[model samples]
Target: MRVSGEKLDDQQIIEKIMRSLSARFDYNVVAIEERNDIFTLTFEGLMSSLCSHEQQMNKRINSTKLEQALQSKASIGGHGG
Candidate 1:
């Protein structure tokens, strides 16, 4: 099956996607109202985890970019055209 410009294989792919999305949406819609009912929930912890993961990813990406830039600079500076 195909969705817009994307191809979706596997049987019931559309249904599965729709169902999962709908369930997530519904949970989000009701989460705020039922916050008190959800004990042991740590939004702060979740945000901290996400922030740490993002920082590590950014560091890795920047290191790779810096290495590439240095290599390119060396190549260009060492070669006379």
Candidate 2:
């Protein structure tokens, strides 16, 4: 599903994206709140560990996307062409 430039619904999009990511990562991330179309995703655990894990995951995904984009491969949100 793609949401383009239009009058989109924030809460629904937030939930949809959250669910899509959670499934992709195989983790149950609870949406604490959806504020201004941003979902505060969280898990029941230590704050430090959670933050670190999130950062690591984000970093790895970014790196992989960058590499693929550099190699003229597919990516979700890495390029505008």
Candidate 3:
């Protein structure tokens, strides 16, 4: 994932990403790496088979929420600190 903002540094970007993921998923970060302002995060969590329609829909909704949260954060010009 890529995050960029005038007021955010590398650490803040990583923290925001981690917070967003943890807020929606019960997962643990297994590995993380950053280079050239891009972040690669590996996480482990329970495996679920989206065989039911509700399950699939929930997954899509959660993904959309995550994407929106990330985009909103990236667009913020400052932390107001």
Better of 2 and 3 by TM-score: 2
In candidate 3, what are the lDDT values of residues 18-50, reduced to their tens digit?
556543342232323323222432222112211
Candidate 1: regions farther than 4 A off: 1-41
Model 1: worst 10 consecutive residues (lDDT sum): 9-18
What residue runs in model 2 are displaced by over 4 Å at the alpha carbon?
1-45, 73-81
Candidate number with the higher lDDT (1 or 2)? 1
Q: Return the candidate ranking by lDDT, descending.
A: 1, 2, 3
Residue pairs of candidate 1 with colliding backbone atoms: none
The best candidate in terms of lDDT? 1
Against the reference, the lDDT scores of all candidates come to 0.53, 0.52, 0.48
Give per-model TM-scores.
0.48, 0.36, 0.33
The 10 consecutive residues of candidate 2 with the worst lDDT sum are: 34-43
